[model samples]
Target: MVMEDMELERLSAAMDGELDDEKLPRLLGGCRHDPALQESWYAFHVIGETLRDPQLPPVRLHSRIAQALKEEPTVLVPKSSVGSVPLDGATQRRWLAMAAAIAVVVLTTALLRPSLPANPVIAQNGQSTPASTENGVSDRDIQTFVALHRQGSPLSEFQTVDYTPQTIAQR
Candidate 1:
């Protein structure tokens, strides 16, 4: 894969007369039989022509672009930081250090924030009885009342576990 990428890079460089004289002949020889490389070469030429003449309408090279993407090698290539304002090594390092410090501070704050004590108002309110229970809607209290009601009346065979008027009426 690396070799393929190198070949493509060399081919691109060769178009601009950047390849060494020793390797130029061999590179040209491979292009003669390589249909994929031939397509790439033609596409590069078309790009150069379009760039040189801004008045010319850009041609759609969808097939060539798709072929290039399909044949692309998964190699990490360092790109030149041209055209934009370039930063010095020291400035870049300082920015990276600042980013790392900010990340550490954020992570530390997140991890420790949960362990802090709850708000006093929330703590007091959470312990208080809910509004429904204040209106005497208690499960245990209802069960006790039902037990007393059951003692005064015997359950009938037609009655279910649920206490209903049908059970008392049958008795």
Candidate 2:
């Protein structure tokens, strides 16, 4: 004769054991037949199992210092096993390479520290010629350039075209 709401109330109270003795089995039996509540129970149990698995990483540690206190101590190495550390050929080569690398870095920094002025120095294309030819361009070269510029100039009043030069001897 118990209603559905009373059954649910019994189930909620059963978790903390506040339910009547006779109602406990009925509340459990009601949940078993309820698909939604049964699914919720399965999900809760799955979460519990996932949390209990040791292979899974711990999500939260309360404090690093407190957690570190629980860890086992590692023993120090015995002196009998330790010997005089000497460099072999490979170790010597590695040390040499490291020294070379450091030297290269220091030299590079010293060489490329930009001691020059920051103003951009631009060189003109035709500004400077070597001392050997410093008296400027040659005369014949200038004459040849003038002749070519005159000969094929479309902008000139007398335009350049296929024209024949007449000789006095042939006339």
Candidate 3:
């Protein structure tokens, strides 16, 4: 694959007078028999001609990007600092507290609901009874939530997962 890439690179570069005498024939020979490569060479020439003329119609960036993405561009954004991705100590403690409280409410409701019979009277106080949580949303969601929070924040060393469908309890 690398040899093929280098051959193509050399052929393209030869057109720009970038390749030396030793490489010219090999590049030419490789490009001559490859119909797809030859078409690429011709298209490159046409693009060059358009660039030199400058009066050619403007290319839509979105179309060009769509085509390039189909061809698989190699660009990738580098990850930032890796440390400090987890919530700070105080914030984690607070989250633990809220989770604990929510769990307590749910447990209390579970215990209290048993005695209320099949048609338990509705509480009209407008306060919600905590329901069973999430059918056990994966640990992965927690990781992603933290990652997304980091992504939205200015924390340079924080960025990772993405997630959905859960909220931290306040009480």
Candidate 4:
């Protein structure tokens, strides 16, 4: 195995024309019997061909290299034969359902934004108004609302219960 590896390395170096001139003839002579060396020599030539042609897909070149080296393929994942697995239909559906649920929640929040109150403010006429009113909310209204909020329970407490004139706490 070690000898084969050494020969393969020497074959690669020779293809690159980097081997000593004295070693090249002996290496070529061994190529006839040593199939591994021949394979390495062929791989180096294929690599050279792949490099020279800019259009060849790199994956094909990689596959060729792996085949020539007789190593487990580093590129091109083999299709699932037995042990290899993919997402089950149920798993895919569950993920899609989750994504759809999230989208629905986001859309609901965005659509409901204009109707929801920014701050709970009991107006002068004893009507509850959102602080984000398009008609424009007065600064005094905001101040009074903030003061009322500071004095009262959290805003959620008033959401289920109706507010009365007494809720305003007159300035």
Off by over 4 Å in 1: 53-171
| Pairs in steric clash, model 1 | none
Residue 48, candidate 3: how far off, in angstroms? Answer: 1.1
Residue-level lDDT of model 4, residues 1-171, one tens digit each, is 698788887777776557665676677668745655655566565455434422222222222222222222122235656666676896667557546644554454345445445555455453544343211113333434543453354654325332222243232
Better of 1 and 2 by TM-score: 1
Tell how far residue 61 is off in model 2, in angstroms: 29
Put down candidate 3 lDDT per residue, 42-76, tens digits, no spaces. Answer: 55544543343222332222222222232332233
TM-score of each: 0.30, 0.22, 0.29, 0.30
Candidate 3: list runs displaced more than 4 Å.
Answer: 53-171
Candidate 2: regions farther than 4 A off: 1-4, 40-171
Instruction: Report the C-alpha lDDT of model 1 over 1-171, residue by residue, as the tens digit.
Output: 697788889877765657775676676567655656655666665455434332232222222222232233223323665555666896667557546644554455345334332433121323532321211112223334454454445773225254322232233
Worst 10 residues of 2 by lDDT: 162-171
- Clashes in model 2: which pairs? none
